[model samples]
Structures are given as C-alpha cells and as structure tokens.
Target: MARFTLLGTATIPGKGTELRLLQRNDEFSIKIAGSTGELMNSRLHGSEDALATLACERISELPSPRVLIGGLGMGFTLAAALKSLGSDAQVTVAELVPEVESWNRGPLGGAAGYPLEDPRARVHIGDVVELIRQSPAAFDAILLDVDNGPEGLTRKENDWLYTSAGIHAAQAALTPDGVLAYWSAGQDPAFTERLKRAGLSVEPVTVRAHRPGKGARHVIWLAW
Candidate 1:
C-alpha cells in the first residue's frame, strides 16, 4: 500500500476551514479537516468530466455557447467542457477558493492537462452564486460541483446555491432552454422537487467515478 503524505493545507475563507491536501505516490487528494471523506481525488473524476460533457454536448451546435462552471475542484470538468465546445464558445469557471485555483494551475494541472490556459476558459476567484445573481440570461449552461452536493459539507454559504432562491438565480442566468446541472455525491429528492417547483425539467443521471464506468456512483442533476 502507498502511504499518504500531507503535502500542505490551504485556508477556505469565511468558515475558518482549511482543506487538507495529501499525496500518495503520483496521485493527489483533497479533503476538509476532520472529514472522513475526500473532497476530490485525482484518480476518480469521470463524473466531473461527465458534468461538463453532458451539459455542453446538448448545446454544442449553438453558436458561441456560454457556460458557467462552479467549483474548480480539479480541471477535469473544465477540460471536458472545452473539448466539446466550439471555437467561439466560452466557459467561465468560478472557484470560491483561491488556493484551489493555484492547486489546479500548479500540482493538479498536470493531471487534467492545464485547462485554465485555454483561451476559451476563464477563471473567476470568487463565489459562483454571486456571479449567478449578477448575471441574467448570460449563460447557456450552468454546472456546479460545489461541496459534495446541494447540501454543503465544506461551507454553509454554499447552501444558498441549492435553495429555491439560488435555483431561481441560476435559472434566470441561463438562456432559453439553458441547462442547470449539479453534481452530488448522493441523491437529493427535495432538490429534485425544488427544481420542478421552479418550472424546470430535471434529468437525474448516475455516473461512475472512473471513465470506463468504474468506481463509486455519483448523481448529476441536469435541469432545464
């Protein structure tokens, strides 16, 4: 067995929370302090890639499609989105934690092929919810993988993103037939109902953590 070594720790603003980064041989993993579960693992990111591919694939033919991706956990999601997008397409990735961005551009970049360097990809170092509240009908698709799910384990502020109000903001930010996708470690029945109550169609997809369809199952909610 490869022993895990603590590489470093980064502070997550506003909650006095610090995320732990661990390295085991060539792999990297991140987790919140005192949490049993890992926030993200470099080796397992099929669902994250699916989050972007599934959303962008639907709007591929649309000219200059704009996408808003929340959480830069790793660049896997962004990389997948960029692959499916056209030349004129734009993808805005909003990451609340600055260190997370650095991690992507630094150690984690090698794993996902440095997506931030893509001209079509832009990184915003702030809360994604704020961006949603500020921009109306600005995106063709909104993808979020913040925390573990709608119910946050990293930051309580993230709770707003899943509430009826946040859903309204995301819905308003999207263009006609625009899709709002959320990635969660598990299922949230109440969140599904909330999406329906907001007048949007929801498709719940279960995907594997690893590509050839292996590893743990995760839920991705694609609402339009």
Candidate 2:
C-alpha cells in the first residue's frame, strides 16, 4: 500500500493552530487539526464537486466579476470557479496555510494546472474569514470551502463561521446581490436555517464527483 509522506507545515493567523501538507506519489492531502477540517486530495469529507459546482453556478451569473474563494484545497474549487467565470473575471483565493498554497504552486500544480498563477488570480496567504470580515461588499461571489461543514471537522472555532453572526458577517462582505456559497460534507438542516435567519436567500444544492464521471453526491448551501 502507498503511504502519504509528510511534506511540510505552516501556521496562519485567525485560523488557529498549524496545518500540515502531505503527499503520496501524485496525490496530496491537507490536515489542519485545529482549524478547517481534514482534506484528502480533492475529496473533502465527501463533497468537493458539490462545492465547486455551487461556486461555478454562482460565478456563472456575472460578467467579468470579482470572486473570493476561501480555500485552495488542491485548487479544485478555484479552478472550477475560474472555468465558470468569464475571461475578465478576477479571483482572489485566501488560503490559511502557506504550505498548502506552496503545494498548490509546486507539485500539485499539475493536478490543478496552477490556476492560482492565472493573471486573473490573486493568492493571499491569510485567513479567509478575516479577509471576508475586512472586505466590504467587494465580491460578486464568495465560495467558502474552509471547513468540513458548518458542524466542523477540525477546530471548534470553525463553529463561529456557521453561526448567525458568521452568516451575517459573510452577508455584509458580499455585494447587494452577491452570492455566498458553503460546501459541507453532508446536509445540516440547522445550518440551513441559520442561513435563512441571516436574512439571505438560501438554496441547497447537491452534487457528486468522487467517482470518475461525477457519481458521488454532496451538498452545497448557497445563501445570498
């Protein structure tokens, strides 16, 4: 059996604790035991395609829009967003772990083709939540794939992002008609309600992509 080798580690502000990047042959993994959930290659808990689809769907509506992506896991979501958005669209990816960002730029670049280096992309080595909280209604769409789900898979601090306050903060960061999308491993009715309670229109979408031709199913919560 093949095993993943420990590549490196890094710490980010606001996200808490440290993050480790692992690599096994061509596959990559990221684990932030105290921050966002564990990400194995492109399969995050269970839903990477679902989240990417949701982000792409939201970005597809705009022409040359500015977008914000919370996570850079294998660059799957980021690449999908880039593909869905127009040529003039600009994407800002905020990755908490510097090593994860480096992995994206280094060995894993071939898997996702280093989309972060696209002229339209601006990679930021910081916390996505803080970036959203600091930016004021600047993005046309904000795709959050930071944690496993609102329930969280890594740290308890991530729970704040799913709370009403977090939802409200996300809403405040979006443009008047902007979309806020969240990728979860599975469905959480309570978190769905929280989005609605945040005074935003919510749409729950399901997608499957783990198997080779999109056969695995996952849930995505789209709130605007």
Number of the predicted model whose lDDT against the real structure is largest: 1
Candidate 2 lDDT over residue span 1-224, tens digit each: 79878787766555466777877777777776554544566443235545655656766766678888888878877777777777898989998777777888887777777788888888888777789889998888888887778876655666788888888888888888788888877789998888887787888977664743454466788887
TM-scores of all predicted structures: 0.96, 0.85
lDDT of 1 by residue, 1-224 (tens): 99889877888878889898888887989988888888889999999999998999889999899999999887999999999998999999999889888888887788899999999999999989899989999999999988889889889999999999999999999999689999999888999999999999999999999875698999999999
How big is the RMSD of model 2?
Answer: 3.1
Clashes of 2: 1
Report RMSD (Å) for each prediction in the order shown: 1.2, 3.1
> What TM value does model 2 have?
0.85
